[model samples]
Target: MQIAKVRGTVVSTQKDPSLRGTKLLLLQLLDEEGHTLPEYEVAADSVGAGVDEWVLISRSGHAACRVQGNEDRPLDAVVVAIIDTIYLEKRQIYNKREQYR
Candidate 1:
């Protein structure tokens, strides 16, 4: 799993049947310092994360496929949770309440 920020949404008019109802999101991976990385990925949204929100992602296809209703979906990543807060070394690095306020 990795921390990421939802950058945007991905829309595909034509896609595999298994992905028909899945919500795809564009995400930029975040470093330990909460800085965005150059790498980007499109991941299925299982937790309904919104753009600009910090999220937890499962990058393993096997783990992503384990999400309910995505059993056999062709997905390499998936948003597992919408992050509420992050703490490192006893110091708070991110707080969703403060970020949105």
Candidate 2:
């Protein structure tokens, strides 16, 4: 699993049948410092993660397929969890509970 920030969403009029009702989100990869890298990914949402939320992303095709319960679907990434907070030692670095509210 990897960490990413939900930057926006993706809407497609025509998609594979397996991904018909799946929510596609744009995600920016984040390093340990919470800084976004240059790479971005379009991931299928499994945990109902929204924009600006920190999410745990699975980049494995098998994992993504398992999340959607469709083995035939072609998926490289999927949002597995919506993070609430990140604690580095005794310091609270990133917290979404306060940001969302």
Candidate 3:
């Protein structure tokens, strides 16, 4: 599991049957300091997430489990949660937020 900001979205005209009808988004990977990292990749969205939205991303098989409570979503990255509020008290910590943006 990792926290990343949704940088952009991706659309696939042709994909595997398992991944059909799934929405994919390009995520701008973030480090602990909330700084954007150069490494970026696309993720499939189970929860509706938009661009520039801070979202919780699950990778590989873990991502498949988050959706439908079963490991069959055929996804490498899924938007399991969206951040609403982030409060860092110098040490960098998540405080409170639940808008699911």
Best by lDDT: 1
Per-residue accuracy of model 3 over 1-101 as CA lDDT, tens digit each? 66788777777777776666777889988876678888786877767878777777777776467577345555666777876656566553543343332
Q: Cα lDDT of all candidates, in order?
A: 0.92, 0.85, 0.71
The count of backbone overlaps in candidate 2 is: 0
> How does candidate 1 score on lDDT?
0.92
Error of 1 at 62 (Å): 0.6
Stronger candidate by TM-score (1 vs 3): 1
Residue lDDT tens for model 1, 7-52: 9988998889889989999999999879989988899997889889
Badly placed stretches (over 4 Å) of model 3 are 69-71, 89-101
Score candidate 3 by lDDT. 0.71
Q: Which pairs clash in model 1?
A: none
Candidate 3 TM-score versus the reference: 0.74
RMSD of every prediction: 0.8, 1.5, 3.7
Ranking by TM-score: 1, 2, 3
Q: Against the hidden reference, what TM-scores do the models get? A: 0.96, 0.88, 0.74
Instruction: Give the runs in model 2 whose Cα sits over 4 Å from its true position.
Output: none
